[model samples]
Target chain A: MPTLSIAELKKQANLIRQDIILMLERAGSGHPSGALGMADIFAVLYFQILNHTPHKPNSPLRDRLILSCGHYCPVLYATLARAGYFPLVELKTLRQINSRLQGHPHNLSLPGVENSSGPLGQGISQAVGMALAGKIDQAKHQIFCITSDAEHNEGQLWEAIMTANKYQLNNLINIVDCNNIQIDGKTTDIMPLLSLRKKYESFGWKVLEMNGHNYGNIIATIKQAKNYQKGPVVILAHTIPGKGVSFMENKYDWHGKAPNKEQAEKALQELRQAV
Target chain B: MPKENKNKSTRDGFGDALLALAKKDKNIVVVSADLAESTRVWKFAKKYPARFIEVGVAEQNMLGIAAGLALADKIPIATSFAVFSPGRNWDQLRISVCYSKANVKIIGSHTGLGAGEDGASHQALEDIAITRCLPNLVVLAPADYNEAQKALAVAIKHQGPIYLRLTRQNTPIFTSAKSIFKIGQANILQKGQDVTLIACGALVYDALQVAKKLATQNISVEVINCHTIKPLDKKTILASVKKTKKVVTLEDHQIHGGLGSAVAELLAENYPVPVKIMGVNDTFGESGTPEKLYKKYGLDQEHIIKNIKEII
Candidate 1:
């Protein structure tokens, strides 16, 4: 696959944002803020960063990506479809009964989805396991786990952090979508996870902070992460809860609630204009 | 009558079997949660250091790691106390292992009253209930040391998520090496027409003894060792209950969701025989010797005999 330029990647991210709005509107219920916020990161991963094949989703040499905060699966489904893992038209069937696109990401139902996740604080530990396996097998494929800032409230997330550090899993790259909004309320108000960079650094992770929506920064950060050979690297991508759409941006109400037809039309109009 | 030999802990059997399997299949990996000595995973750790993962008291991480390894086409056996694995890290086991349909084996040691002297917090009376209820998880509580070893082999051979409930105390080894061991298959130790004695885990030996003692009194008892609690052997149980007309279920777990519950549910749905469920009666177990605990918890041969006599 040829490398996608930063402008092209940003355009893809905008398209993914549009898909997120449309899918959430069609489903009548889904997380929109986190999905929209994670578009640029997913675009960078599926389009340029990840060493994966859309056709051979189970190829041994392909890099593994785990979605820890599975509530934000619209971003993943839209991105995976856009990357040709499946038909983009199937994106409309999100959260429908018997659809491969479950409310939470199901690995068995979809190809390319490495781990099924819905509950918080589980994806990182699984990534640690995969990275450990990679180390044992001497496999070249890296393991990437995408988690949320709010899920850091869970004790299990810290346990996985300690594990990844103890194992010195340099092949693992954890991307934290620091959207700062959870279902209940703001992350700091709900449960203080301030000083995340320092926290990860103290946990022996190579911490990298960047503007999550900036395609160039995301690409650079991922490249820098791939170079670190000391321990596991965590890219704390600071993201707005909703990026492209103005009304939903930085609003916690859109954290879980889906847009109606008018709201989705507005969001899509804004995204299309941005593109 | 089956002679009472030297007692052996089922966890030891699991350890030995794990080591044996790891020796043959390099793909077999053991993940421990700082209970290597208690869970008997130290043997495999000592043998194959590379294949053994010491997650250091993190049961949740241990299970998640096992799921990850399973995803990578490696057979990962995660070992910890029953309470910690199914009790504390249940969500991980449910979502990561079972929901994902990962080929991971969960060895939950120190289950039931066999976790002697550790008190209620340590004992896992609700393991079978929690694990068996999960979709795509095979729950097995072996009869004795010999059966536990065979169960480990079978769990290793089988794919998907499995929870092998093991005991801490040295219970009597009733099943021999030659005993037929199959997943979801029950063993009929002895057959009788008067009443049926269905049991699992360490209590199987006690059930056998209860049968022999009852036989002397002209009360012929049929004994079935139900090692595999989930995907239960309905055929053997139904067939045995058909002959006996009366049924008594026994286990080392809570009566609500253990072998007794499985048997009761099976019989109630299919045969509808008069059943007497024998197990820990929905109460916390305090610190005590395994023998004293079993007796006090109404899981001994005496209790089984008492229940049998009352039902008959």
Candidate 2:
């Protein structure tokens, strides 16, 4: 597939946000904030950045996209569907019995999911392993681990950070969804990770910062990460908890709960107008 | 019994097999979590420096990394102490390795109450129980050096996940070097009639000693090496129990969720028989010599013999 221009990517991202709202509304229970928040990056990744063929999801030559923040799988499902991995109708079956689109992604059940994640902080470690394997085989494919902010509290994530650095995983790129809101309260309130940039740099990573919602910024930062060969690079993509809808934006209340039917309609209306 | 027996740690077999696998297949990579030397995965690390991933002291990350390596079509042997890997990283094993069905061989070394003086903190008494319950996982508790080596080879060839429990102490090797190993198949070491001594891991040797002593009194004892713990070899276990009519399960693990529990559970349902479980009772172990700890925990040859005598 040809790379979608920034304007086209933005439109695609907005569509993904709309799909997220619709899917969550139908599912009756799911995390919405990160799903809605991380749409543009997903759009940029699946449409512009990744060397993936939706028809052949497990292609060895394809770049591996690991969703460490599995709660945001609605966005992944929506993006994977839009990219022709499966039917767009499957999005409606989110969290339903025997649906491939699980509340958390399962790599076995679904074609496009690189790793299964539910319990947090494991995705990055798995991604690091994939990166190391790629390096060992001299493969050209990159391994991108998309993680969230509150998940940094997981000690294993830091452990994986050190391993990635120790291996000098140049093909490994970590895109942290640095949206400040976590379930219960603000990330600072629940568990303060004051400066993730400093934490990454301290672990010997070549850290980069990006605006997660901006298509051009996400694309550019990712490109810069792809070019870095010194060691593993982490792009701390700062995102709003709820990006498109007005009432939900930056709200921690939207962190773990799905939008009701009325709320979904309103969010979709706002999204359609905004688009 | 073999005329020349070479007493060796089961971990030696683990290290040798890993090195052998890496030599034959470049896809076989060894991952260590700071316990490489103890687990003997260090041999492969030393041989193929590039193939070894040293993930320092983090069992959780080591498991996740191994899963990732499997995703890239590389067979990764992830190593750590049993108490830490299956003990602490069960969640990682469940989701990352088992659920993903990643071709990752997990070496849980220094298992059971046999790790000697390091105390209860270092020993793993619940690895079999913890690992057996997991879906898409192959749990193997090899009886000796040869069996452990054979189990590792078969586990590597299998497409999905396998967890092999190995011991740190130099155990008395009983099984032959030429014994054929297959997943879910039990080896009937010494056959008799009056009673059956079902065992696994280092305790398999203890069971043999118990069986030999029982033979002096003219009580025929059948010895079984139940190495495959998860898919408990129901055929071998049940068939032995049917003839013997009395059973004694032995292991260096706890009475619950180990070899004994599997045997008891199997017998209780299919064929009801008097089953005596000889293992560390539901309690933590303290620091001491292997002999003292074994005696204290009722996991020695004397204890197995007593339990079998009572049941018979």
Candidate 3:
């Protein structure tokens, strides 16, 4: 497969956002704010960044991706479906009883999911393990772990941060969607994350700051992270809580709210034109 | 019956096996939580720097790091005190290693009262119970140094989450290096019919001594080294129970949820044999020598003998 260019990646991001909006609308119960917020990063990773094959999801040589913030699973599910990991039709059965697509990302149930992440602050640690495993196996494959900035409040995330740094896990790439809106209120009011970049940097991680919604920046940062051979890399992506849709973007209420049929149509319409 | 035996710590076996495994397969990585010398993973750490990760003083991170390494297809053995592995970073172990079903070996050194002076804080009396409860987890508390080395090798070969519970203080080495060790299969150390003594960890040697002592008294006692605690060998247990209606379970862990409880649960559900559990019976141990703690807590050969008599 040819590597996708920045422009092509942006187009794919727009399509993924379309899928996320439509999937959530069908599920009638899913996270939208963080899903939309992570759209661009997901696009870049699936289309260009990761060395993966949808045909062989468990190929030992393929780069591993773990969705730590599983609530934003709609985005990952949409990306994986669109990437031909499974039929895109499976997106409709997400969160349904007995469906392979669980509310949280489950590795055993779902192909291409490197780790199961439901409770906050677990995926990153699992990803850290994957990266360490890759390094040990002498595999060139990297581990890309996407997490929510709000999950930073969890002590386990900090524990993972220290481990990743201590091990000098250069093969691991942790991307945090720093949208600032959590479930209750503003992240600052709930719990201030004084400086995530500095915190990770102090823990011996190579830090990268980028606009999460910017396709070019996402590609550039990931490329930069690939070049960094010193230690683990954490990309603090500044994104809107709800990125594309005008009404839902940056709204705390949309954190886990699914779009109704009418709301879904409106969300898709707004997302299509904006991107 | 001979009382004094050549003593060897299970942690030493872990250290030796890890180094040997690393020599054979460079993919075998050992991660320690600042107890390298204590847990004996330091031997591997010294030989294989690339495969060794020292996550200084953080059990949670040690587990997370080991899990991450396993995900990448490397067999990682994470070593720390038992009190910390299952006791402290249990959630991490469950979520990262067991739940994900990663190929990671969680080595908990200095388990039970055998950790000695570290006392209740360091004595992981609950490791077996806690680790066994987690689904898809391989919980093995090997009896002696030979079993520990074999268990480590076995864990490396198995493609799933494993917890190798180790001891701090040196205990008697029961099985010879040539003894074949397989997970989920009980090693029958002594054969008899009067009663069965099922035990694991440091207590297995003690059970063997008790069985020998009971044999001289014309009381034939069966001694079973119940090494793999999670996948408890029900066939051996049930078969022994058929001959000997009474059972005495010994462990250096808490009597409530350790090997004793696992055996009792199985027997209660299937055989309905009378069982006397010999362990730290529902109490925390204090700062004392391992020998003193064992004698006080009724975990020594005498204690096993007494417990066996009570059950009989």
Q: Tens-digit lDDT track for model 1 on A1-275?
A: 45698889988899999999999999999999999999999999998988988999999999999999999899999999999999999999999998999999889999889998999988988999999899899999899999999889888889889988988999999999998888888988999987999999899999999999777788899999999999999999999989889999999988989999999998889889987
Off by over 4 Å in 2: none
On a 0 to 1 DockQ scale, where is model 1?
0.87
Candidate 1 per-residue lDDT over residues B1-312, each given as its tens digit: 355568898998898888888888989998889989888988788888988888888899889989999999999999889999978999999899999999999988888987999999999999999988899999888888888889999998998899999999887776787777999888899989899988888888888888889889999999998888889999998988888899999888898977788888888789997999988998999999989998898888788888999999
Better of 1 and 2 by DockQ: 2
Q: Tell me how far the alpha carbon of residue B233 in candidate 2 is from the true structure, in angstroms, after superposition.
A: 0.7
Give one clash count per candidate, in the order shown: 0, 0, 8
Per-model TM-score versus the true fold: 0.99, 0.98, 0.93
Native contacts retained, all candidates in order? 0.81, 0.95, 0.68
Model 2 per-residue lDDT tens digits across residues B1-312: 764377888999888877777788989998898888888877777789999889999999999999999999999999999999988899999999999999999989888778888988998988888998899998999988888889888998899999999998987777888878989999898999999888888888888877789899988999998989878889988888899899888888888888888888899899998988888899988888878899888877777777777877
Worst window of 10 by summed lDDT in candidate 1 chain A? A1-10
Clashing pairs in 2: none
For candidate 1, state the interface root-mean-square deviation in angstroms to 1 decimal: 0.6
C-alpha lDDT of all candidate models, in order: 0.90, 0.90, 0.84
How far does residue A263 in candidate 3 sit from its true spot (Å)? 4.0
Superposition error at B269 for model 2 (Å)? 2.0
Q: Tell me how far the alpha carbon of residue A1 in candidate 3 is from the true structure, in angstroms, after superposition.
A: 3.6
